[model samples]
Target: MALMIISSVVATPSGNKDISVAIEEMERANYFTFVMLINMVPPNLFQGNVTFLMPSDRSLSRTMVPAQNSVMDLLLRHSIPSPLLFDHLLHLPTNSMLPTSNPDLMLKVSNRGRRSLFLGNVKIVSPNICTHGYSVRCHGIDGVISIEKPGLASPITCPRVASAAAPLPLLAPPSPSPSPSSAPASDPPHGAAYETSGGVRPQMELALTTWMAFVWLLYSKAKLCV
Candidate 1:
């Protein structure tokens, strides 16, 4: 893949004449960028001449594509699925928009004449850049048709943007009361010393474990227990 030189029309379907020379014809007229992409494509895949609704260097540059494989997809999107020429365009009426190779994209033709050709909102600069056999009418447009810019999104391919996090699910919590249970009223062995008899201890019913301990101590003391 030279990425620059288009070899022959032998790569074209139906054994069309070598349009590579015609591509040069276009290049001489300063319409090289669009034609060059056509040349980069292998002959087997690229069949015949079709009207190329070309975006100018300015239009192509405006596209913020990653410097990688995505460029290939962008190229395919610009090329129409079928072979069509300017003559074909003349027959089409106003507001006639044709679908391109890409499902998202569509080529629109309006205001067609010997003076100019309009694709979508773009003005076609070079009519019949390579119109010998099939045709490669290169048009110079103001901007490229961005199909996947806003709509196309996949689970994996789309970016993990900073979207507002979903509200968390409410959860159930435990009660504040400790386990309500009574303990046996019995004193510990003689050696054990307990703090009591003077006044009532604080109603320290907090965690389950603390509540249990309070109950056990209260049982050990006979009256005024804890």
Candidate 2:
């Protein structure tokens, strides 16, 4: 969808500026949430000088994350803490990562040309949502921006808190990790006779005894003849 740029509804630092053009621009681009966020925010809180980085409706719907994840945090990750337009953005090196309010700790930004601005790895389909304000530039991206992981798995336990009541310890920093060693190792059972102690049948024992008797008789006869 082609975004509509409206100018009457926008808020700015100097005075309230008409954002009817940016509004129309965003509407056409299908950035419904971005429009709604701006419209919903308390006018005074966002009334000061600032730039907004907005995502499209499609962008929000495409994430693999659960819905409870704060949409506001994700929005802030895309927005620069300061007001910066494309022309000003040019000074930054390409492939530079920017900081954001999200705990994820980082957001990626790369510019291919005046044509597009990428946020986190997503492509911006439409930028400069409102035509009236030079400070605010809106770009539509293919996906949502990234933030620092809210809670990550830890391989090691964190240090315990110390208190006036505590166990005594006689310890230095733990020694280096133990050297590798070899020993008998338990193996998966794959062989036959896992639990049996003897032959498959008792008949085999009698057969061996009969053969021994025949050999002894032949030996006695030979000795007597000699």
Candidate 3:
């Protein structure tokens, strides 16, 4: 049996316009290739708000399409889960990573001056292509969004602080106390000539000896006269 490929979009439980309306809008904007690719997926798979980035029909034909299992990834790479207009996109700062329907895919934004803006490798050529509905938004891009492997981490280097050497212990030399030999001599008490080692006073001994001599000479003179 031949493979039967069917594409249709149904309304979500929230009563929003079906995603098919946005696909039709892409069809009107000369993005028939992208519309067909979306049509290949079952409508039941789509839910919530979606923003589709559609390249020109020529760009799609020139680029190779992915395998059946990878087509969903292709669509996810080009689509953001939220509806954003060109003005909204312009407000996004440079290097802002916008999440997509698929958790693994993220669209990096590069904002240049004026109307120059980029989403991943694709450049927004036409802005606000789908603004009629609330659930989906579409815009024209210059090229297809590139699909690359994830999980590669950026390199980081930690800075080292300057270490100071520990301070050496300070040693102060001790000073010596003053000795008696180094001290100046003080004057003795008045009337005392000097101090003797035997502790006797020389002035008292001289007075006693002079008295005895006087007495002896007197006695001798008297005896001789008698």
Candidate 4:
């Protein structure tokens, strides 16, 4: 329960000239406790294009204050609904994720360049400290922003759609050639099941010539009834 320093007066809204010149460039960069937590919220939550990410003031004097209804979810988890700057956050490339303004928090970056950037676990340490506000920007981190717990970050993977190769089991067409005098066989083990058994060997030789003409019409009607 420490952060309640107020006094820079920022009630904004004179048609919010970019959040009043980004709260006068975050009070000339002293970042007075993140400009008193952005004057305790409201001003259309810093209207439109944001990008604050403040923190410093010795990293909000060692954290733990946000209460008045969580100060607009602690300035929407230290803003960033777009107006980025520090060279547009140096083309965000390290695991890049960003999207804060609290929609379930995000900001993953970490770029590792300009004196070592970073985001989720803080570190910016005063980048473009609110570039003369063309929609408001800010920067200056080095602590505070730690909310990242969507199952402890780092898991975007998504590119595994190669599963369509299982249709090769239709080989059951070779059971009729067993009647050539009832049993002269043992040579059918070549390759690919005997090359697919010659496509059903002419329908198994027309079903063995109609089963030998119905067994010679029952042996010519038992030799003409004997």
The estimated TM-scores of all candidates read 0.48, 0.46, 0.58, 0.25
Question: What's the lDDT for all of these models?
Answer: 0.53, 0.52, 0.67, 0.69
RMSD of each: 22.3, 27.3, 37.8, 22.7
Candidate 2 stretches greater than 4 Å from native: 1-12, 15-25, 63-69, 101-104, 115-117, 148-226
What is the lDDT ranking, best to worst?
4, 3, 1, 2
Tens-digit per-residue lDDT, 74-181, candidate 4: 778888887878987888898678788777767778787889888777778778776776667778877777664442145444332233223233446755533344
Deviation in angstroms for 117 in model 2?
A: 4.2
Which scores greater on lDDT, model 1 or model 3?
Answer: 3
Error of 4 at 113 (Å): 4.5
lDDT of model 3 at residue 25? 77
lDDT of 2 by residue, 1-226 (tens): 1232234333213434534455666777677777776665445434334555676676666755333335454555665655565566656566566655443455555667766666556565655555466444555656665544322211222332333224333233223344335423453232122233432223344555665765565565555445
In candidate 3, residue 33 scores what lDDT? Answer: 85
Worst 10 residues of 3 by lDDT: 152-161
Q: List the residue pairs that clash in candidate 1.
A: 11-43, 13-47
* Candidate 3 residue lDDT tens string, 1-226: 1233222233323313547677677778888888888877766556647788888889889877768556676787778878788888888899767776777667777889546897777789898888777677889999877755232111222322122223233333223334446344674332123364322345445545765665565565555445
**In terms of TM-score, which candidate is stronger, 1 or 4?**
1
